[model samples]
Target: MSAFSDSEIAGLKVARQSPLIILQPEFVVRAFTLNERLLVCNPNGRLDAEGALQHAYFSDFTDV
Candidate 1:
């Protein structure tokens, strides 16, 4: 990812599959791996990629 601040990210535009919508959140981003797996930031936190997807926190922010 580029060295962009949270504000910069939020100001930028990102295309979504549902062309009618967009996700330009103004907050810190959660990094992910090349294989589309979320990186583990906390050892005690949920470490399962498959499990994380089931949570409500999961969002379709993956850039096409």
Candidate 2:
């Protein structure tokens, strides 16, 4: 059988749909492919200097 049949293709399309939503100026949401997400989310992954600094700065603030 083929890898993806007609019904499976339709489900895949639905699963990949992303809807835009607005957030506060300081916050953002992004979408990534499975591999990209895995790399970024990996426990062993390291953040670059700039990213680390930004994360540190943001870590000090609370929404309230």
Using TM-score as the measure, the top candidate is 2
Off by over 4 Å in 2: 1-4, 12-25, 29-64
- Model 1 ranges off by over 4 Å: 1-23, 26-37, 41-46, 57-64
List pairs with backbone clashes in candidate 2.
none
Q: Report the lDDT tens digits of candidate 1 across residue range 1-64.
A: 5657766988988865642223533221332332233454664653575666553345554431
lDDT of 2 by residue, 1-64 (tens): 4657766876764455453444332333322222343467656675555554445335544541
Candidate 1: residue 57 lDDT (0-100): 42
Structure candidate 1, residue pairs in collision: none
**What is the lDDT for 29 in model 1?**
36
Q: What Cα-based lDDT does every candidate model obtain?
A: 0.46, 0.46
TM-score of each: 0.21, 0.22
